[model samples]
Target: MDVIKDFPIYVAKKIKHETVDDLIRQFKGLQANCYDLMINRVVIPRDKKLKEIEKDGNADWRFHEREVKFIVRTENGSSISVEFGLCKTIKSLKDYLYDVKKVSIDQRQMTFNGQELNDEMILNDCEIINDSVVCMNKKNGMSIDIDINNVIEKFDENTIVSDVIKFRKPSNAENYDLVIDGKIVPRNMTLQEANISQQSKLKFQERNITFRVRLCNGSRIRVDMPPSKSILNLKEHLNTVEKFPVCQQRISFNGKDLTDDLTLHDCGIKDDSDVYLLGRLYGG
Candidate 1:
């Protein structure tokens, strides 16, 4: 027990406390016990035999932890299940995910309720005593087909989007920095900026859809926007088109106002890109 006490103090002297649980568990798994010595409350087995010298009266196990199943999922869509009686943060769960599912922290993101997982949640706050749904990361399961020859034929020079747009997804990246047909579009652009019309070549899986329409002026309208603008930015442009700023302009996509602050990507304007503009007919 003297050796164990010396080990935690020795290892803790140089290492971080977060990894101490794992270091103690890994090197001493099935060989010794762990304890709730600090603000943490898990009373490990071998800890009882070790000396309890109180540097401060606050050193004690606070929560009577109940063993709960932890399901760790990787960014690559792999998952592993285990049980722990100790309370931990999502970061620790992610470390456990990496250990069990071989997931890299960079490649993974955790989530709940279709939103990206927030690191601020806690077990006691979330109230998980047993097997519970912790979090999930959504995976982009769709892909497209690309034609390099068509790209070269469309433009005198090669464009990155013409070559790679098929392989990209809306949710797969924070934004897509694209140069399409010689136009530079920053990440987080909308379909309108690309001048993508309903009749334009829209390829989903193996299906392609095209749209052609008439504008309020009775003139032909084909979606052919500059490829470098985002839908929200485009909305701002549209506001100017009718002489109103986004905040002052009252409009909606099918009767829903896209938040004044939302980028078009934030409003689910991915495949169909069905953004119908609304507003007063007169007044800039």
Candidate 2:
């Protein structure tokens, strides 16, 4: 009787252990299956969207290094189009387009918002983004103002300027190779005489580099940026630079929150490109 009782206890323990092992195995299988399903679902759609956004001349999806195809409406009402790596600089774009259309580049001035276009501006890689940065339908008048106050405003106090100067093209204004105006200033000029302060949104210089920043509407402030800096860091720097109140405002790239510390390699920012930073969209 004692042996039989002990035998029953032993068998019960073994069965219990086997049951626990089976549960663990089932859990692992479920995790693996879930992982596989998620990857399948995400990767397929992502791949398709990427393909749709990508453009090529022959439906081949061959993206250019820095080329953008422009839908230019000629003066004759005919919309002519062409593609080239626009990043070769403003000068390069004018020269090449002149060559293609056989018009003296001198006759065709690049004026973004009326100010002659500068070669330092890099054309964004995406066709849609590049399409938006407009050029001259008219020559924007250029002038210099003398303000002893040494402060200017692109708009309201939400964005103030340290005697803010405007960005201009290479030939439009330069202190020589010394100051590009919006670019590297003569490493030697003190802020007082030049009065060129950090609060300025746009400035030009005759320098080499393909970076530009554009603010949307008038956000009580404007921030300057270097070309190579990532949009992620750029946004943080903008917040700090502009003194944005914590949680009062949110920032977005194109139309999305800057999720990661994404490099320009991932951010897709270009000169004068529209970066919509507004009150975050309201939704459930």
Candidate 3:
């Protein structure tokens, strides 16, 4: 009987221990449910909202990022990638090159598809796209030194002969021939085309010839002009120097009317040749 009574006490202790264990497990499960509720109610929504914000921010960035990235290939076969806004000018690109490549702005010449790029041209206006390859050449690379009227000037080999002449003497470029090594280079050809190199010495040979112009009053005036000049140029010169109105002037050579577009050479005018100038009569 005593053993039976002790067995009941032992059973009560075991039952109490089992109740505590069940309560502990129930409390842990309640904690987990609360954690899930917190996450679903607040944390998950916040994370989704943050992701949406990040997505929108990226879209906005992409929308405003209007930049063009291109590659510049130098004469030495090296290349570099550059990026700029579409509105940026070519001058800005040159400035960047000067800073990075240590090249002066005047010496750096950029070209796209064989067309020389102007400094004032905008990047977008040049039709440059992303990943386009631009060519960068040093202007001094093929330049030749030229002496004009005792003043030495450097010009590129690709420079047109007429352009060099015009730079030296605007009013008389067409009348001058570029002489190198005792030979006359054609004015219509570039320095490179004329076989002129960096070591070449250039001189200007004036081809001016004196001619007589008979005015409407039958008075003769002596003029020195180049045969390459158009009659329009002559009329303009007369307008400036003699105060003759170009619009009212009419010229005839060899009894035939000379058009303004005809060059003196086209009319076969030579030294001491005489031409008649008459005033245009306008009727109301």
Candidate 4:
């Protein structure tokens, strides 16, 4: 006669916890007597001590790390699958993209499913589960391509010429004689409105016109401006690049304040005209 004993096989799975303290408490409560434990693809001997199990390559057994897979869709309609630890943060995932996928992006500009992701938020906090799809958008600045007498030039569509003249002095930038399809392009016009495109051809003529902006401190900056540009648009450019608040900016010439609806040409401003700028200080 033969006697056989059969023990129930318990699937040894890693216990997941939100925090290290919780994991420690749960791990301490696990019964150490009369049980077989398996970790890291290695089976622990029944008579082995905890230190011996660790020395046998189960040092990270208590971490109980799990993998989370997410598919990130880019702006260009491309997607990549990224795998991360469950305890990792959104920022860590971004870093992984940068490191592994060669994606260069700012953390502040990252978004998932139309909602911006916080850097400190963990994958679990974002409710990201296995096989989740994340969408990432790139923040692109406005760009316009123009043809200057058959030569191509690209500029920011949102930028005003008054601000541009400060850096690069294009030929006849002041005269501002840019024409498209027999229509004169206004200096204040954005590239979007100018019908600027990579394929569009435009003509430009040199006009000997320049304007000077005199600050309250008596310092002056000379600019090449087309008289067709509006004073209001100039103020907006100053507000953006020079830290001059638009609400606090005042433009005056020849003892008359400039209005938004009027262009420099309408105000009787000609070449080499001097405009005064009054910027007010804002405080608490």
Candidate 5:
């Protein structure tokens, strides 16, 4: 009689345990679903749109979201006319290439008006308008001989210092400084701002300092930095390389916290010096 009475309670406890396990599995599945929705459906698209707005300094492009027709020309002289949505990302175009042209994303590299297009960048953000020509080439290591003068041979009065650099240094393009008449030309300065003409001779010099970044995961990353650039610049570079956002990065050296405004030179950070990087924890 006691066993029969206890059997109902025992069954109830077993059911309770199974219910908890099932609930946990369902909760985990829901979390995964939500994460996918947030990242793919919301976050990435929103980021692309925000970048477009920031680039144009207004939301004017949103009103003109029509089909963009452009040419994708391969290095081997083959070409195709692709009509895609203006709001679509370069990644989507790469997907189209994979689907139609059988060009694997890993094997392809693209450039527009002598500037490399990032995967996250939108078509309109790249200034790829109607009839724009996009050059497609096989993914080669950054060994392609680039003649700076030839690259900017068509430079006019409107060309900025950055334009020349981007045209020549397609990879890690930001790390270079333009030197004209033995003076470093400010990146934001135009030819007119620097009192230089299209015929002026210029030099692209990479002014970078190499250092080691130790992450919380016990892995180290080699960072090449311009000594004059601030810690904030380092964080931004890490954001690009490591995909960790600037806001979540906490950096320290010699057991002291480094402020964003402090330059690598200011911190007395030399080549190969170990800088520790930590990710900030959220929600306890």
Candidate 6:
């Protein structure tokens, strides 16, 4: 007898073996007349995803990655039609558009099926797998001729300055700086939101291995930080160099919450890493 169970959409299937090939065959059959399965979950690389599935024998049976496709349209009449994992975010689609079409959208206003979408929203929410269309209404902006460390990048207005620093093409650097007209742009803000325009003279500040930090108070600071150092050490260093209060500083690395006692090595912080510092002031 086949080990049968209900699938995502109430369809029934069997999983005799937990291998990649086994899972593919099972999902393929479930789609039957359809071209392929649509998944909106964070589908890691095939090898990695499979490794993870196989590693844990008692894994939550419902936590398998699904394959999905999307059609993203912009108000300019341009559209992006591609397949991605359901675990991917709308921001991922925006990043893809920025990479291929050289255009970006303000996610704050981008919507699908008349409903607004959030950066954290997954493809599953759109219910678009095969031929669904996501409408993009014009709201904010895109990037052009923005120079970073001597290299030029065409960014969408909605692209985060820090994301650009952490994930620029060719090679990934640990840290970077976005400076416009002698003033540093906040990594968290979009280009258009930051008053960055096509004609603005933008510059990227980068060092070989050191990382930079942007405080909440519109100030920028650079540090010669190495991955071998502990987060505690860096906090102490900041307290001395920038007069920042170590105890009052809350630092996050790669979106991971940091403990004051953890080291860069423990937190996987590397050279050129981007560090975000939240400092607390004593009095107004």
Candidate 6 achieves a global lDDT of: 0.59
**What lDDT does each candidate get?**
0.41, 0.38, 0.66, 0.58, 0.63, 0.59
Structure candidate 1, residue pairs in collision:
33-46, 34-44, 195-223, 195-224, 195-225, 198-210, 198-211, 199-210, 199-211, 243-284
lDDT, candidate 1, 146-245, per-residue tens: 3332332121111223223323442333233444465554322223334433323333222112222223344432343433334566656655555556
Give the winner by TM-score: 3 or 5. Answer: 3
Off by over 4 Å in 4: 1-60, 139-284
Query: Which stretches of model 5 miss by more than 4 angstroms?
Result: 1-64, 143-284
| Candidate 4 worst ten-residue window by lDDT | 1-10
> After superposing candidate 2, which stretches have Cα over 4 Å from the reference?
1-64, 72-79, 113-115, 125-130, 137-284
Ranking by lDDT: 3, 5, 6, 4, 1, 2
Per-candidate TM-score against the hidden true structure? 0.25, 0.25, 0.32, 0.32, 0.31, 0.35
RMSD of each: 16.0, 23.1, 28.6, 21.1, 20.6, 13.9
On lDDT, the stronger of 3 and 4 is 3
lDDT (Cα, tens digit) per residue for candidate 2, span 144-223: 33222243423221111211222222222222232324454332222333344435433333222244333455643444
Off by more than 4 A, model 6: 1-20, 29-143, 169-174, 206-284
Error of model 4, residue 76, in angstroms? 1.5
| Model 1 lDDT on a 0 to 1 scale | 0.41
Q: Between candidates 1 and 5, which one is better according to TM-score?
A: 5
- Model 1, runs deviating above 4 Å: 1-63, 75-77, 135-284
